[model samples]
Target chain A: MIRQFGLPEALAILSGVQATILLSLIAFVGGGVVGLAVALMRTSERTWLQRCAGFYIDFFQGTPLLMQLFLVFYGLPVLGYKVNPWIAVAIGFTLHASAFLGEIWRGSIQAVPRGQTEAAYALGLSYASRMRNVVLPQAMRISVAPTVGFMVQLIKGTSLAAIIGFVELSRAAQIIASATYKPLLAYGCAAIVYFVLCFPLSRLSMRLEKRFAVKT
Target chain B: MTYQFDFSVLLPYWEQLLRGCWLTILLSAISISAGLTIGILTALAKRSRFTTARIAAGTYVEIIRNTPFLVQVFFIFFGLPALGISFQPWSAAILALSLNCGAFSAEVIRGGIDAIARGQYEAGTALGLKPLQIFRHIVLKPALRIIFPALSGQFVLTLLTTSIVSSISAEELTSIAQSIDTLTFRSFEIYIVATILYLTMSFGFATLFKLIDRVYFSYPVK
Candidate 1:
């Protein structure tokens, strides 16, 4: 079966590995920044501000990203604004990642000891100063493993973009599978590529867990 | 420049949409139950003393975790047919969703089981209980109690993910919405309604899980 398959066809499917990598990068960085803001808003003192953040997170996280992506990629045109599939995919994935990453980071931030915040307050530091100088610094340590862990989810989630007709690795594999009439080989290679992308992160997450455990 | 929002156009198809929702519900329920069993077994395998068992369990988890559910569905729906195992869209979708949920649930359960104190297991052994009895009565029951919340969380995640099966034409809520969109050209309204439906379903399931947890666990949570 292996010898029967042509190399060029497999290479065609493999080429889209770059798109998968790019999709993950955009979601990771974009979601990271937005997630930090949402996490801050979630912990804010203002009631409405906290509620707004809560709604934002719940709405995005509760519903499926597939629907969200369709609504963006398709719904936007109905609203008189049309963008390319890639932009819609990015927006959809970025919003989805932000909600999850926000919650994860919030847990990490809250996991920091209450004593640390009290100490910062006693030192006459402002709320902003406390978060910037003390709370965030400590939370970063607890956040490493989970954040890296989520990258695996974010990367895998990008495969949903294929539904809207964006040609990512999975989509490319679908195309090749159709052309070559070799669904198993094409998809097997695609799955292997995804594994290659995600396996290292899984190992890194475990290592971080151990490294962080020793300190705590 | 006024476009009046029209929903009456969708009225006639309400029953069809409802049927689709029911399918989605049934698909998710079956996947959740089946996935939970597979997850617990895999989690146990990963933690077993046998190296082959650990590797097999770990490989299943890593493959499922890394790949998208959409791709997995495609592989099963399209690829398996080549290997002479034919599956309808519904069965393939359920299989893929269950596999995906199994991986995540295994990790959550493994965490819960691993968090158990060694003293508890030691006490079970010292009580002259068989290893299998100790596992069933001592290890698993307590582990399920601790991990119930995480397990429910994964179930909700699985519900959200079932939308991907729509791509393979499983006729779930999202697929029904797609047809409605084609007919009425009200993409935003149709999707907005679908989005609300999804949110409501997810919240409803979460609440139901909470009630189940309360009734079954009966451990007053702080």
Candidate 2:
């Protein structure tokens, strides 16, 4: 039975906006925590730590997200862990986000002037205090714009979870389109919802970038 | 965990995997060339004197940038058929990729164009150059030099994006990996191999771009 592409169908697709947002949030927060450690490691004095962090970033950034998701989804089972699409996608996106965010923050950390670190050292501040009090605050300010910019990317990326049958916005659109045979309406509606969710963030990112550019 | 690993099962399908990589490279090549053309045109339109052309170009870029590429693919492949415009999976994949890349590269190209000072154009005109000659001699080369690094980076990104076209069942490496997974049930092994192949391709292209930048964009030191 072919259902009509009515308000009900549109709402069904729109319903998926929640899952998409939730997934993005989970990935962003989870990635942020791990990403901070990665960023610090990349900027550390230890050559081995820097090399390990560099490889981690390159491995994630160099491959397709689809393959990464597939690896976790399938690889987990081989290791004798039960897997579901949600768990797999969450893990995949978190790792991907960490690599990207880690790289961004590393750049920001380095962008802090050498004079600041020198002054902290001259004041007899320890390495931990120097980083926490002097370096990271400035780096955080530099990173805000790009971090918001990345949120836009992360939101759109969540759509890939639909491919693995996670029932997100894109998957919901697929379900409706296939059922109602109104691919145009189903996908178009989903696209609009995504735009609404993403456009403001894009604009805010650009605005923040401009503001920071002027200040710097 | 007593799971035994077997990668030898995929050895028999090496030819299929190779073929898939060839198709991916083909798709990316065609789309990048086509997209660059579209990008140049759109960038010009965005800078045009006419209000309509500027708005149209701006609107296209904004809409494409804001939405996901997968939905765009679905809309083109499946949705267009409703309007009596249908494409084969491969054609649809190329069209979507080109359109997506065009929007992104337009912004990058436009930034390059804007970086060129107005005095350069006036200088060309003072030298008795025609407008077309002015653009060719004074504008294009330097603009390309300025944008080549970002443009090549974007191209690498487009190459990776070709994998997403697999969702529409277009013939590519990722799609082939899925097929082999069902056949051998060695999902982990096959994906590992595919990921490594992708890593190699990206790194290779990045190195190649650096070489091209050195060859083409570096200015002669006096």
Measured by DockQ, the strongest candidate is 2
**Candidate 1, overall lDDT?**
0.88
What CAPRI-style quality would you assign to candidate 1?
medium
lDDT of 1 by residue, B27-128 (tens): 899999989999999999999999999999998998888777877898999999999998988888889988988999999999988988999889998999
Q: In model 2, where do residues sit more than 4 Å from their true spots?
A: none
Q: Please, what is the TM-score per model?
A: 0.94, 0.98
Model 1: how far is B162 from its true place, Å? Answer: 0.8
Per-residue error (Å), model 1, residue A141: 1.7
State in Å the error of residue A59, model 1: 0.9
What DockQ does candidate 2 score?
A: 0.88
**Clash count in backbone of candidate 2:** 0
DockQ of 1: 0.69
Candidate 1 has an interface RMSD (Å) of: 1.5
